[model samples]
Target chain A: MSEPNIYQPFLMRIDKITEEAPLVKTFKLVFVNDEEGKKFQFKAGQFGEYSVFGEGECTLCIASPPTRPGYIECTFRQAGRVTGALAGKEEGEIIGFRGPYGNTFPLEQWQGKNLLFIAGGIALPPLRCVIWNALDLRDRFKEITVIYGARSVADLVYKQELEEWAKRGDLKILTTVDPGGETPDWKGEIGFVPAVLEKADPICENTVALVCGPPIMIKLTLPVLAKLGFSPENTFTTLENRMKCGIGKCGHCMVGKYFVCKDGPVFTLAQLNQLPPEY
Target chain B: MIIEKKLLKQDSVEKLFAKLKADGRRILAPKAQGDEIFFEQVASASEMAKDYIQTTLSPKGAVFPRVEALFRYQMEGKDVKIENNSEPQPTVIFGLRPCDAASFAILNSVFSWDYQDSQFKSRLAQTAAITVSCSRADEYCFCTSVGGSPGDTKGSDILLTRIGSGDYLAEILTEKGKAMVTLAPELFAEAPSEDKEKYLAKVPVKFDLKKLTEKLPEAFNNNELWMEQSLRCLGCGACAFVCPACVCFDIQDESKRESGVRLRCWDSCGFSLFTAHTSGHNPRPVQSQRWRQRVMHKFSYFNDRQKYLGCVGCGRCSRKCPADMNLLEHLKAIAEAR
Candidate 1:
């Protein structure tokens, strides 16, 4: 085998940063070397480690679906050191990034089946990648229902993108918040993600439910999906954990014997059930 | 032939060390400092800690470094430039014990199994281990219970036993070890026929390896007992860190502006985030559940998947554990329980 040192490192420059919400923002990155940029590859559910040089490093899932190329997106909240440093970054700034690592969402398995997307708060970013990937390949699936909500109207992310998907002729989109407020324009459901999912009454047969959000929302949604006749095999979800390394070697992101970066950032309910009940 | 205690002079050992250095091979041996011992790169035999017991840190740091570079990268206009990692140099680790050597075997199973970890594989290919047989066992050591003995050659290229004060008998177990000794044949005194019998007399534990291996299957799915056993662990990861067989790692990309390098570092299972999700869900939130996973992986799951035991029973965990949780006591409890 060739010496590992012979392989050059991967570099990416931050082109833009958009404030998705008060606590969340998305950074647009492009490779420094044009040839290396073309060689850059990643799957939908894969993530990358972004670094703030002297401060430290943090892991973020690739927020953009594989359907889109050239530019990559990483959405993160203002937490911890590196993330806080990243939050301080402005447009056209330079940062370090490597990967398109981890297993992507199982798009092949969901092809020709109905896709039910359930998301909560800012957790919608990673799921958004799948939503766009499915929509781009709309002919392959039966139906798409997106149920998303957060603390309030201001807390909802990708409102413009959601508006675009809602405008499409063949999609059902429902919006909600935990507590309704004085905002007179609010018209969607006002409850938790699980409650909203039940009210939507998605068909479980020949369908796969893709869920993401806070831990409490996920805990509440699993039973609801089972109640709606979705087998453990038919339900899927993405995972986020405090990760120091985006690879399996760093012991931070493991669930039983499975490493989230390698075995999955995306998993079916059946696989999740088999894992140790830590996350 | 066994040399009398008086005949084993320090000068003869120095000549062997000088010969190895002249051949451009690095020889590492244990060094004694008061009550603590450590493996240091050696210049001569005088630097070796032949009389010392266990070191504070396992010699694993020599093979799989505590910190290693994976790759380097730089950024330009929404693009990334990545450079691959560099390979390490070749070296032999001398005087490793059976427990430490067996840890390499356990590590090999994980690094080489599913997706071959090139970083680990490359270093392993160029390395050799020379293990010394235990003349006196420690209070914490229980290698006999975990498919290893003080004289097992599972991960050793050469097995050495002291026949007399300074005269050692070496059984060349691998081609690499044969090469190691062939480089300086004048240093090794030819072994006498009775050397094997003298070594076996030092066995400390009457372990039923077959019984322990058989009882492992019955312990699977018994979470309640595991929970009770692991209740006191503070989840500090000290046990995993000190263990010779644990091989979990974390990879990170450390960057400065336009340049960044990927790094692979050691990790432990005792942390809460070992199995946490970014979406705020944690599967092994409780200490009991995490501890169950540790035992299950070592004894049951690894065996079921890889057909290999995940522990070498170096007893470093038992020796270093502040909570005093020992794998041998726990396994014995599980095996003897009704």
Candidate 2:
């Protein structure tokens, strides 16, 4: 009875909120307890269970980079009941958070390799953590290229960050929208994510690829990456199964023998190949 | 832990029950409701159900409630406050079968796997299991095939088996059991001369559990096998509800504007929505896949990860199944398959 609760969450204050897209918004959260804030740590691929008091908890990746400490950010669309509850809140309001769960992306192993980030729609938040981390430590890696796409120009999240990355001389950014999903003045390429990735074919040797997107985007992009000589081991992605506890218990998320909350939210394509297609 | 064997007179059971009740411990024993039996709190041993192989539902609700409050949350102006669930009362589950008793360990393995769950831990820690050995088993019983027997004292505080003289052959198996003796030591007599096995039920090993576990991973993609086995499956979730070793759950928030409690409720893999995402994507969409998950998770996944099998061979699912889906027959078929 004296043990600390695994279900109880830390009180987090919403310090800042950004309206990223039409329905997508990001909240920058800071721990209300100063001691708890100082002790909190998470890696790139890890996620958390964010609660909205009246509504239930939602499993969301810590969208902000671990390299930039002191605050954590989460971007979500007004999709479901929990997410709708989350989106209703404004800056300075409080929410409940408990996490930093799951395995981290092996950033130390990919230190000297070129980083290729391919993301689609809302899935970009999960990959953006590692993308920003790799960019912040730009001197440690080679050429970094990002190919991001959405259903339409209005659907693309992190617009400001995409603009900032495009202006950065060190990085290569390619933005795309689906066929016929472009606005009249849309400057980005008009195509699906896989086509944009195939068009902007970067060399695959000594490169590490991180892909996160809808199921269809992943299904189509994997062959494209494989054709470009990126082996299964060099390709990585984070998986999201419907989870409740966001821990090993509750038993909502599993991809074969592995507990996605414990064994991974992040897995190499080779590792995923070893598992059954349960997620 | 070493177990000390002793004899408990049939009349002494009532005395022990009284002593436990007087000691401020809540005693939950099987009570017959119409034809079905359930675990409920009783003041006297006479209220205990007679001649029941297993309860309609496993005594799992004793250690893990059907619905439990994980935490309480309150909205205070712009801030939200969190409250940890309070500790449970000291509880003793009496007259559970050995199969039901053994399931507590499987539940323990899951709750304490990597991140220890305090709510489950506290509930389990405060609860002690006292099991009665089964002297009679129906066709549904298969505990022997799953590495357990009617007289198995694996997960019991005290294990009691009725001998030739109708007296209980008591195995004081744990400190918790000894504590009950400490409350009233005079009630326990000298050890009985009768063999405890003579009084227990004979449950045959219908299938090879080791072979079944080994065959599960190989049978993962055997769509024909799963589809055939699950053709009659209603996806009713009755199997999980009656299962002692099934620990899957769902977390939800129940609120009335300002104050709310986060509840952990029972869930089953067989339910389609159990693995369905909000984006209209379902990984295990079909009943056959869900059936395969139930089989694979219990036999293959739990053994590989937790070092404990997720089924105790209680066969409550088969007994209570509206579809008359015999799990023993299915398991035997899977094990004997080429």
Candidate 3:
């Protein structure tokens, strides 16, 4: 058969749904066609356009790692029309998915080096795939540190995964909430992520830092990472822009000459420094 | 490769149009619509505008319409069934100027870039463009500045240059043009071997493209210049709608209960809502920033990707702009920026 049209989406059924946080849900989707499911492969940091049949499509990074096959997972918060419709969907419901688009994180370059993942709020989904991928291939890397923060303790996603990482003897996981966001029984750090990151002080020597968050969080976190002696070339982040066509035909998600949908959703800080700050 | 040249009498041009229509080809040509000339469906050659300098809108809509249904979908229990739209029919676009023809080549680069849009590709494959060499130009005409001319046949299937009062010099460019000739071989004759450049319009170079390319990146951080220049701009998006090379689009679904159709509609970066995120954060929060994006996308970003300027110097944006936000003036300002 001829190649399917670029716009036509593959039917995917939601096998499982987990309430990651307030207004946020993680969906485990399996391709309805077994042939398509066997043929699909994507690395960490690549995204897909998920559609809610009658609503519209939204771009989201595949939250599940490639090591786990048969199904792909995505985490999304109730934000707009499409996400709202997706929030209303139940298990066994089918949605449209098109992708595995854009560039992947350069994990091979960070082999044998310490890996530090820093994410804020709902932005953790983009980094979760990489975190698990590195953990799955544990012997290849030196040390793993995850510093994730959210607006409040209730807003933190992947709670079960966070507990599992915290219990692991080989990795260091630091979770935090914003100032005044902690309850009376809170055990994690209580401060802004950038400030807590400075206090945690993961050694910058031969370490790769992956950071993803809101624009303001990213803007403030980069300077702190620079101050902590993290090389801009080794520091990476993924940008989220409003997109229509995830394959770069639509011109909404451009940062300078780069299309976020094609050239990158993942970029090194050194590369981001060269681009215009429009994203 | 040597290009074959032929001649067609003005009276016999109507016969070629009749023959094309008889073959069930849709003829899209520049026709008068109230006060403005637009590229609309024409039945005969006489219905086409005879004295228009340029069409108000470019012929880009022939392949990429303003709004088109991508696919229709209906819910079947828990499953959704999608039906693709029918492929476009063969078409012939007559009376397009050389600048407008060149714009098609620029649009092709974006549409065929990472993801091949089947709707646009199918329509473009079946469409034949017949460009007419310009005999007159206005102050807004600056095709010569951007590596195009009044007689350029870069994206045309057939180029017609008026050689005399009742005759035209035809240069068949592609296989489609050759096929059109086979339809009415009796009307086309051997060219007379004369200078056709004398009859073409005179469009002067307004700015240095090399200098503009170099200075545009530096001007990206100069908010004062962009803000001052775009202070009078009203964000109506008319410029983007009229521009042939502006290919930004939005995908939306219109559903009624159990069934719906997804549509791809024309969108513009000049508008404030083009890049606004769902979380109430807008990257381009002001009109100046949006205007800067439009200028930089055409002058800088496109050159980086395709090694060609997105603007074909067609001047449709300037002509259709509600406010006097002239593209040539901004480009010249960028070229002359320190």
Candidate 4:
């Protein structure tokens, strides 16, 4: 690891922009360096600080699979100054990017074990990086299951990826949408992620569950996993809060004693349980 | 080790000021700007405010500026060109209080510990601190409670205390301070018989430093005390910003079009965004939890990691605090708690 202060940030030209939902969009960026195509790397679940010049900076998780190098993709929602400006950007536009900051999920530790991936709403983007990495290297794991949800059918992201993964036939992909909405014309379940997890009755033995999404979804889903006999240690999740620097130095992104950017972007539920009940 | 004396009449002091300015060294002293005290570069010793409390911003800014360019860069066809930004000018900070002097010592740990930050280190190497003892303390001052005192002179090269009319007793504690005295030893006058009495009476011993340090570890596990103590704190982090010992910062890259520069800026933990994640989950969402983090990080975590207390007991946070959260009261509560 090189010294953190030696981190050099440069403008990455936006090669393409894909609208994932009404609010979420993915920006594919190629670094200013020609050699960037070969060396740009990030682990699954790690994030970066993206800047829109005069708009300031915001933390955005690298959503594209790490194995798929060259272009780094960040999926963002138009919530604040930088993200709103980033959402308004078009193809070939320039955006500032730094990092691959923070710790990533321990994928190597999960090899040969059954994996359960749970995500909700826009949270799917960061988890998708891991999901795709797992699928690409399918033989390394025993079984792969993805449980995902959104507010409505329209709120769901990566519809095309869902179709492709469903066709894979080697893994299980479960999806749900919140109540009080027009149901999609599909052959899948519809309910909150926690309720779906209880109904799906995922096997807890020899398995690890990776959960991500809104706080409400996680708050409700954790107990359901526990009820299904998954210990806190066997569960993992990625949490987000508003951030300026994606490094531990910035005072804001703390979860008790932990610096979310440094100590975790990924944490076991056992570790999460130790935190003050604020998250 | 204490140098006790009275100021010489006009000629000796004038020679001291002459040597300081003749060398092109920037000497920053405190000045009364309306209701606030601020450190400004002085051309002569006459410009220094003899009586002033802590400044609105600490002398930390003189070393680590609010905004500084790490490097300049330009974008070419496929590669970015970069240039190293050189060090700033050498400076001597005059008239720092003990709390302020001690904060620099705390800052030294953070910048030099894990990875050497040359940007801050270069400034520390070039800058020297001249501390002045406080004759009277305000409600916002608790330096003695946090391993410091009104007369604690560990961080300063040259420590001064007022003894008589138009006179100062200077203690040359370090080689850097000895160099200054060597340059102008003619400024020194013979000590008066009553100099020791004036030194003790003028600079009052305020708090028991040893008792406070002993009580800190016992206070660490008192969660109820911390919870109630931090109850009113809005968790805005204004306290940390105003504190002399709070050295946390955030590094950000600001770029325009094709190129940009990475900047380091002051940051605090009270803000919700400070710990927020991109995944729309925050571990410290409420005021209680955030407040706990502030106290625990300073008192427990930093001590565990660096073997030093994170605070210097400066009540500047309590003085400038918007919410009126008094750290002195909290410390006392922790000290007395079961």
Among all candidates shown, the one with the greatest DockQ: 2
Candidate 4 docks at the CAPRI level of: acceptable
After superposing candidate 4, which stretches have Cα over 4 Å from the reference?
A1-8, A35-40, A179-184, B1-24, B66-85, B111-118, B138-140, B161-238, B248-293, B321-325
lDDT digits (tens) for residues B1-338 of candidate 1: 21121121334557756766777767778888777677788887778886755666788877777777766666655445555656666677878887788777667777666446677788788788877777777767777776677777677887776666556667777887777677777666655664444554244563555565567656656778878888789899888877677777766557677776767777777777676654455667778777877776777766765677877767788888888887778877776666
Clashing pairs in 3: none
- What fraction of the native interface does candidate 1 get right in terms of contacts? 0.35
> How are the candidates ranked when ordered by lDDT, highest leading?
2, 3, 4, 1
Off by over 4 Å in 3: A1-3
lDDT of 2 at B90: 89
Q: Rank the candidates by DockQ, best first.
A: 2, 3, 1, 4
lDDT of 2 by residue, B69-163 (tens): 88888888987777887789889999999999999999999999788988788889888888999999999999999999999999999999998
- Chain B TM-scores of the candidates: 0.88, 0.98, 0.97, 0.87
Q: Write down the lDDT of every candidate, Cα atoms only.
A: 0.74, 0.92, 0.90, 0.74
Chain A TM-score for each candidate, in the given order? Answer: 0.94, 0.98, 0.98, 0.94
DockQ of each: 0.28, 0.84, 0.65, 0.24
Which digits, one per residue and each the tens of the lDDT, describe model 3 over residues B1-338? 11689998999889999999888899999999898999999888899888888899999999889998888899999988989878687899999998888887788888887677778888888899999999999988888988999999889999999986659999999888999999999999998898789999999899999999989888999999899888988988998998888989999989998999888999999888899999988889999999999999988889999777888888888887778778898889889877
Runs off by more than 4 Å, candidate 2:
none
C-alpha lDDT of residue B122 in model 4: 80
Kindly state the number of residue pairs that clash in model 4.
11
Fnat for every candidate:
0.35, 0.83, 0.68, 0.35
Winner of 2 and 3 under lDDT: 2
For each candidate, give its TM-score against the true structure. 0.88, 0.99, 0.97, 0.85
Question: Residue A93 in candidate 2 has what lDDT?
Answer: 92
